[model samples]
Target: MIGTPRIQSLPQGIEVGIKALAARCREGEKRIAAALRELEAFGYLQRVRDRLPSGRVITRTIFCNQPTALLRPRRPAPARPQASAPNPASEHTGPSEQPAPEAPAPLPVPPPPPPLPQAPPSVPLPPSLPLVPPPTAPKLPPGPIPRPDELTPELDRAATALLSDLHRRAPQFTLTETDVRQLVPGVAAWLERAAHPDAIRHALTDDPPVPLKRPALLLKHRLTELLPPAPPDTQELAALTHRPRITVTPFQTCEDCDRAFRSPTPGHCRDCREHRAEDLRTAA
Candidate 1:
């Protein structure tokens, strides 16, 4: 009989289904189908349906550490017979029962071997090698320095994306013309390495102004640095604005948990709960 303790030690559903599965395992079609159903119900169990030597699909249970009581003991194999040589006297004597021949004489022993010579002592070498001059390193010419006009497009796009992510984070910080001009020098220098120089210039132009992204990014970075991570629900944000009916600004999401705080405490999103749980764990 299969041991209850061995099966009970396994994951829950599999343990319960063991008896039902044994008979089905012998039946190829039923075995795989039953395993599949079990797997679907309990995702933790990793079972595979494989084709047997009989060309039929069967459930192949893997990684089971069944106790001795749960499994049948394998039968021991029979020992092999040893081969014997024929008797020499019997082979030679047919009609005349002849005796065995005498054994040959032993060889003579030689005189004692000579002793081996001992090895000579090792001599130390004198350390007086002449010093050779070291090889000179080649001098490399300095590369030409980049000018402001050398800003590339790829650099601009990278800066823009970074700024966009930052702006999304901090809504309180407002960007201004002065801010753009202040960031222009460093951004122009960075643009030299960017692949798309024109894109960066377009972003900075006064029309819509490209440099706004930099200041916006800086504001976001500062805001996150100043504020604590957000609470789970938008209720906190709604209370801050004193507008329960109003929709929350996308940037107002909690730094800790990205839950929109427009509504009351209980209305927080599912992710907010996990975020809060993690926060509690860390705090503890």
Candidate 2:
């Protein structure tokens, strides 16, 4: 009997399955498979197939908790003695000189170990088909749904996948096609507004309902209720756009030194202008 999937409490005699191993290792199925292969190659793990009386085949993966057990070589089993065949002439003379050698009986074999426990059934993912209208917001706080700097086909796909996979975490949120279609717009709205896919998932999945008859409606309701305000950049951009625009004072080129000046028409630059003004003052 495997207790919990925790590594610290792994059952002594019971063999752990891939799922339990994954939980213990804190890894996904692919990583667990790779590690299993390495361990098996290094003699730390072994997989055996067993056929039950019910005609069902199951695979058992055994783990060697104490690796040092492999280092010590096991003593070979003792072989039984075999009796020699008797000659026909010896059989006739038998009673006096032809005493037959005694044969040791065969050793009894032990029965095979019992089959492993069956794995749990896998859950189905929610609908992922394209949204009918993507999703519209009910009434969220105002600002902007700051769009991505470089939008890609990937963002929408990721959002859709996140919504579709929600059922895996919460069984109550088994979204149908119509639900996905309806809720997708709200998710899209969140993503466009710079919300992370994970954040969106958390907001929608946090504290799931017990007897959820309509997942889409609840999600739709959350779409507006839990909707976050516009991101910082959007706020900054709004601030900038709302500010007054400044007008520029055009400059003209000086006829004397090719220098630019802010005047209707200047014969020279500031130095020349000051010089002319000083000379005119002296002459007066």
Candidate 3:
């Protein structure tokens, strides 16, 4: 099994149990089991039994890179030799044959030395000086705080603009208010992380490596994948005091086509004006 190319090509992290291999190869469990048994008999597969600290036994299957011809059974250890006892006849004869032993001579004692004179007492040392405290660091001046309106509505506007742009560019996706609400948090997170709106738009609109069945799901995935850098610190935000604002243009209905358009003249749209000019030229 280890020598098989198909098994070799499998990822290390992938599960390679009998059932998993069977599913991957589109084979029956019985067939896989039989194949495993054959491999075991051929010494290509080995089972190792482990005793866990919890007293539970577990068996693991190992794939041998090189198969063995035969497996030798473990041999038992040799028995240890016991100590021999003393003979009773030798103990009985020892007292009658041996003579009494003589006592050892006493050792000579040495004389003690005379005591020496005592030394004078030592003088006391002076106490240490007290330690001086360290100087405190200078405080920094407070930075300019942002206006309440400016701080509160940035995330909201960014989210709204992102969703609106997505709808305008991909009308076929048919994004609803519910979807917009659900996707707002993600957009706001990008905005909070200091990502530009154009960057977010590009990330969402870029062609993915694989075809997408669900636009919402793909968008969510891209949002996570293309996460922007973290939000700038207070000092950086203070440096960026001004932000660009969007201006809304009012629309009026064209008299000829009844279509709404932004025009200073307010009488007709570009299309209606073009058509009127063409009509006059044809008549002339």
- Top lDDT hit: 2
Residue 221, candidate 2: Cα error in Å is 0.5
Every candidate's CA RMSD: 31.0, 26.6, 32.6
TM-scores for all predictions = 0.14, 0.30, 0.28
lDDT (10s digit) by residue, model 1, range 90-182: 665358554454333222222233445778987988987546644665545533322345446755555445434433444433456555434
Please estimate how well model 3 matches the true structure, expressed as its whole-model Cα lDDT: 0.64
List model 3 lDDT by residue over 1-284, tens digit each: 32346665787546556877878886778877777777778765655554443556766565543454224332333333444576666676345554344332222111222345578776777877447534564545532211122334768777867876785776544466777766677787777776788888888877654444567766666666666667678887877875666776679899988999986557899899999999999999
Q: How would you encode candidate 2's per-residue C-alpha lDDT over 71-138 as one tens digit per residue? A: 33434445545556766664563465744644433322223334567889879889787655446635
The runs of at least 3 residues in candidate 1 whose Cα sits more than 4 Å from the true structure, single-residue gaps closed, are: 1-149, 188-284
lDDT of each: 0.44, 0.66, 0.64
Question: Which runs of model 2 end up more than 4 angstroms from their true locations?
Answer: 1-153, 234-284
Cα deviation at 107, candidate 1, in Å, is 99
Q: TM-score of the candidate numbered 1?
A: 0.14
Please tell me which model should have the higher TM-score, number 1 or number 3.
3
Worst 10 residues of 2 by lDDT: 104-113
Q: Provide the lDDT at 66 for model 3.
A: 44
